[model samples]
Target: MTALTERTEVRPSSPSARSPLGFAGLIVLLVLTTLFVIGLAVSFGSVRIPVGDVWAIVVNRMLPGVFDVWWSQARESIVVGSRLPRALTAATVGAALALSGAVAQLVTRNPLADPYLLGVSSGAGFGVVIVTVLGFGAGMLGVFTVPVAAFVGAMVPLFLSLAIGGRYPQPTAIILVGVALAQVFSALITFSLLVLADERQLGSVMHWLAGGFGDARWSTMIFPVSALATVGTAMLWSARRIDVLQTGDDGAAALGMNVPRFRIVHLLGVSLLAGAAVSVAGGIGFIGLLVPHLAGYVVGIRAARLLPVAALLGAVAMVGADTAARSISSSLEVPVGVVTALVGAPLFVWMLQRRYRRAER
Candidate 1:
């Protein structure tokens, strides 16, 4: 079927979904909820800290000019040194992934268009593998190199997917191409580990591939957060255009909107956000695939409504998932990706069956 026809299938009939007043209220609640979740996450670690102290530590950090430092060095070290950064990074990456996923699904006019579904994760993984195998840099510079390479790597699948789908937004064909690309990258990642990486390196490589926030530092939050802020703002500002596009390209052009220009810009924005998220967090999947669908139950399919809500929901899910990953076992910490997969897989299956059943009915 034509891209236009396919887009028409999910056309937004719930125009009220973008109601400013209603969403403003929801946004306030979500923002507060997200803060609470962050605090909760900070309170739990290998050594549990009180929630009250967690907030106090955050307060001191935020208003150092005002609040006197009273907390012990160890307490300060635990909070500022590790937990806070991981918690903050989790929120940023989750929001970026979910927002990108929401836009991706809209851009492709497909229900399942996500960074992982479209090979962006594999591509990012490929980048990480390249850096790890090549010994690109060392010390501080080396730490930075992986993220840079991963961002570049993430773009590979997006561009390839576009090229493969070539002058057409055939969602089915594009998805298939993306899957194939992902497999190629996944195999290459394994090969790199087997041939290049040593025994001691294997464990870290595996964790990075699966996704974890263990190495997070306050410095880690900088790049992905900046990318998310810029691209996310662009997306929110273009919400009306996205709504127009949902009715398909013809509708957008008839309304004097630049459909092609919008799609090109839109793809770039998604790539930047999704790519940065993958680079920072490794291959944490399903926030993109799952969060938008859940948020859609409240916000409808419009970009304006879905984007922000999905972001908040995604933050909550990721923070919670990360918490579980680290907390569940003192001896063997689970990968955050595995945690998300456990939750996302069943939900994804249910969504597919429900969508098809609804379509049939």
Candidate 2:
């Protein structure tokens, strides 16, 4: 049979099984759910807006003149200026984290790997601490200092990892180095908090480390979304090469793929994506590790197909988690990172159990 016929035969036949419609349907459901969650999530917090008012605010801003007759300026400012940016920031950051995780797993061939496994998050944290303690993130300089420090922190480890690894470095070795560096950075962060930071500064650092979108502003949204768009586009362009690389280096070499070049390109892409994410979001965890696995189970392991679906799922997961973080308690707003760990740890254990059972069979 021809290649076309072979391809056709390999695919499932039933519309339910074969057509991407089901996946498309899931994407649609996820999008709607994300919108609802954002609406509900915005209506929550210390000052609550009723659901109806929240919806009206969103509609008036989004649709402009269509709802101008009934629009309230105060409500519009709350939803459009405050909550909307935070919600979108949460969604975008989550998607970037998830996509980064998926790429790391594929590149390393390790199930446990996430964006933080490379020391990126810890490094960024250290950078932020340094700026904060040194008094650079104060007075007139505070606005731009944190993100600049964070970006530097993220880049250091990424470049170091690439340098230390040389050609064809083992994935396990890279992760080991990352863990060590992360520990070292964490110690520095603790030292800074103890020695230099005042109580208020320490409190601010602690809060940032915990991770939330409460500080998110329209300006904060610009960098990450721009980075995601550019880097995500690059990843999609090279999706076929990434898929080939998944079949083992030797297998990829045999297929005439330049394994090293492919690896470097993709790693750089992930570093840029992860670094940008850390610069803004302050190391929210697990969206990357959990979302990709969930997406793969739903959409199969084909990298080309998996990338976009995983991104969408990641966005859904992040938005949902952010909503839960704020609404779970009346008096306390839970950290986004903590919420993600709560959900991810249990899911990971379940996945491990399932894998072990499959192995036993």
Candidate 3:
């Protein structure tokens, strides 16, 4: 466990292993793969839509309402009205979470850094449970209720973390607080689940905690997708700063960045992104924790290159997970969170073993 917090010296001085054009090409390829995965996800469900008709419906919807398409309204409704938005939501949540995780790792300088690691997801989940326990339920805020509560809950921890850590993540103070909050919130959620939710509500609440896209809607998807776009664009621009940030506070300050202020601001931005995602999706874990490591392996730790790769990987992983969750069992759909955990846990174990092997060498 101590290995999780051990600071690693990023190999920034190594000669660039990738050319700009090559990196751009790789990113484009990954983006295409992500799109393909989303398409694949959209093509299957309780009522499967043919791949060709899926595109036609999407095209007709994208164009003016007058555009003619041969597809049946039910098929069009299934794709346009149901699965497309869900797939888009999955993609957006994946990208935002992976982006937030990467940023969290760089800022905290901890290999275990993730949206949940900082209590953001737990906070947001607690918010949802609170609303649910009160009977405010899903429609309380209309479409915005859960997400709004989630974003608000998520921000509280970020603020408290900064206050406790004095806006610095060094020496593990923030980590400790985050862990404490995570435990506290987990307890609260469990209590709410056991005491507050009825048997009929149990499945929904559990699915929410375990993470599912079954209830995804375009209205609920818009805010997080907007946050991802805005914050993701800012993240791309801040790549150089991110590199500087990984160099330690004194080093970054020496290089003309305001260490304290920068940490606070970046934490706020990432919390917003993570919070929005958590609000829409439930306590989906590990995509954020695991994708950044995979991205770093593909493109070095430099944020510019890492962000896109992470986003693509995250998007594909999420959509793929969602697709599998729905299709794997005829009797019941697995939660997307469970799929991610099943995938990520083994990867995490492998990474730990590889880390130890490197240490022995």
Candidate 4:
């Protein structure tokens, strides 16, 4: 068979699936839900500020001297100083991860592809571990140490996969390579922490590896926000090209698109996004894997349609998970990754089963 004839096929969504009104409503609903979730997340930390007061404090801070300071200094500090940043960080990290997942799915043409699954998260964690072990505080590199390290680490697997898979590799080959690399990186992280880290450092690294937003602050938000804005926008701008690429390399080349160049740029974009999420949130899994699939159910499989919905859903899930982590234990905060894994694992299995059933039909 010719290259085009040998390509794997993907069925496009039916005309019934295209509904602009429904898409708009979904966006509006998700936006409102995101705001509500952020408010709820800010309201229910250990101190327990009211939801109404949380928004008021936010407005007061933004428009200072407008709303009277009815809330105490302590309450204001908790709302604006601590909880708000954490909540927003979760939202931003979630969106970045989801976008990365959507892009991974598109490029690999694999529903199972995700940053976490492909070892990108493990690589990022390894980078963070290296910095921590070396005692390389943010002094020299400033706030960029973790993010830079993470992006570098993330690119390793992506680059390796591209090289191993060749100019036009199969999806299964890329997935296997990613899975193997992920396992190797994860083992390295464990070995390094066990061998090099002190007691306090070990505990800290372990918590971060488990993933939570506790360490989040206004300063830490820069990497994720900027990454999401820049890379995410670029991906959306190239959505039609992504749609073309989905038809396989031969089809894309026939359309006069540069297939290899497109994949390289977008895959690097995906790495940057995943690295940003891991830099701030620390090895949170499933946001990337789960959110895109969930969004596709509502918005269909087009990149342009999937990206926005996935981002919003991811933001909601992360913020909601963080809130649950805090509320789940009065004495100790649960890791946000644990909550996502618990929810995601079951959903993933169901999705797999649903796919099988459809195939059998």
TM-score on alpha carbons, each prediction: 0.89, 0.88, 0.91, 0.89
Q: Candidate 4 at residue 289, lDDT?
A: 86
Which residue pairs in model 3 clash with each other? Answer: none
**Model 1, which residues run further than 4 Å from truth?**
1-8, 17-21, 65-70, 138-140, 159-180
Candidate 3 lDDT tens digits, 1-361? 0123566666563335353557868878888898788888899877887877787778777785655667787887788889999999999999998988888778767777786665787888788776767566667677787778777877777678767866554636665676677777778888888888888666666767788888799888887888988987898788789888877878999999988678666766777788888888887889888899888766778877787788889899898888888998988989998989998999988987887899899
Flag regions of model 2 displaced more than 4 Å. 1-21, 46-56, 137-142, 167-175
Query: Where's the lowest-lDDT run of ten residues in candidate 1?
Result: 1-10
Model 1, span 125-238: residue lDDT tens: 878777677566424365677777788888898788778854565445655666778888888888888988887667767788789888777776777899888998889888
User: 3 or 4, which is superior by TM-score?
Assistant: 3
How many clashing residue pairs, candidate 1? 0
lDDT of 2: 0.74
RMSD (Cα, Å) of candidate 1? Answer: 3.4
Please give the RMSD to the true structure for each candidate, in Å: 3.4, 6.5, 2.7, 4.0
For candidate 2, the per-residue lDDT at 110 reads 61
**Number of the top TM-score candidate:** 3
What lDDT would each prediction earn against the true structure?
0.80, 0.74, 0.79, 0.80
